[model samples]
Target: MSRLDTQIETQRLLLRVQRAEDFEYFAELQQDEEACRFIGGTAPRAAAWRKFLQMPGAWAVQGFGMFAVIEKSSGQWVGNIGPWHPEGWPGTEVGWALRRAAWGKGYAFEAAVASIDWAFDTLGWTEVIHSIDLDNVGSQELAKRLGSRNRGRGQLPAPFEDVVIDIWAQSREEWRARKR
Candidate 1:
């Protein structure tokens, strides 16, 4: 099996490779107005279908990508969160997008910590960034908790290039220091 098919578990959540069964839950997240507002706006199921497959494709092409975030206790797909860096991305970003119901539960923080550790220790990434919209206060806070800080402006691949975002990041040395 591909490395993406492997599973990474936390105390309360399971991070696994994205799968077809996750489409419905992912579509629901894409349809959530509040959750999608910063990530790109609510998308129709057809659009969500195309977007949903991107992570798996990323894994095949990049060897690493977002993981399907599942609630351990409930066995429900909560969202996707992990290292992502597509063509023309500002940097390798550890991003997250959870369903509305999963908000304020600390899941993002928990999963991010684990993902960042993997990116640094396993993937040997020197650093990680979070391309967050200026208005995404929640993600900003999460980035802060991850020991990242707003570095400067950032750009995304075409179609999203016009969207403004703040680059929040930290070096592996910084993250290692924080862990000590």
Candidate 2:
């Protein structure tokens, strides 16, 4: 199996591959109007199920995908955050989407740091980007905290092509320097 299948542990989070049992949490996350507001709109169970499979399918086909963010204290799936690059993607991205309950807890920043490290160190990526919606102030702030800067507006592939987004990015060298 690919090394990307492994897990990452932080003080308060567990970043790992998606599991069958995590689907329930994933579905619930998708259905959360507030949580899904920026990432995508809430979906019905059937649609959520299909969208949920995208991560695992990406792992199987691309050897890397977003990691399921688990809250260590509760052992609950809190969100998905990590490397993601699909067909016609804007760029190699380190993205995130957390449950509304997980917000304002610094969990996203912590998990994103680990994911970005893995992307550059293990995946040999030279840079990482976060494709954030125009109005996602929280994420834009997180990107700034992570030392990423908004490069400019970007376009998503079809179905989301009209959505306004900005590409926040930092190079591996910049990340390494910041960590030091």
Candidate 3:
């Protein structure tokens, strides 16, 4: 099936491959200082456009990438969450980033659960990781809630090499056990 044909639904959200129509929402999140702080700092419109395209590109090349999350009730683009592993990435990861307005609603956690399940069951991954910033307490908590513990410090590639991050992860067996 085409990548676009792939979609997963939760009680309140729809997770699917990124599409052109989602770019505006993607760019908006990229420009939100608080929302983008942990993921990457805010970007200008031009730069946001480039950054936004990376999801689809990754899906095309890698068969998996962050899914554009949509709120089922309002049918609004809420954020991005799912499998992501780029060149020189620390490991296969299940990451998340939501618009500021979507915060405090448990959307990230819900979407992340589905994403991690997909990464393991569908993608046949043995393990999953979440590379989180040191000061991003919110994400750290979310990672913990998802049954991941900080494995230790890890390095990012090139431009991000200087940035310190913690690798939070769990094996597929661990995840399956938790879900039981």
lDDT of 2 by residue, 57-109 (tens): 88888889999999999999999999999888889999999988899899999
- Which segments of model 1 are wrong by more than 4 Å? none
**Model 2: CA > 4 A from native:** none
TM-score of each: 0.97, 0.97, 0.98
The parts of candidate 3 lying over 4 Å away from their true place are: none
Q: Write the per-residue lDDT of candidate 1 for residues 24-91, one digit (tens) a residue.
A: 99999998898899998999999999999999998888888999999999989999999998888899
The lDDT of each candidate is 0.92, 0.93, 0.93
TM-score of 2: 0.97
Model 3 TM-score (2 dp): 0.98
Model 1 scores worst on lDDT over the 10 consecutive residues at 1-10
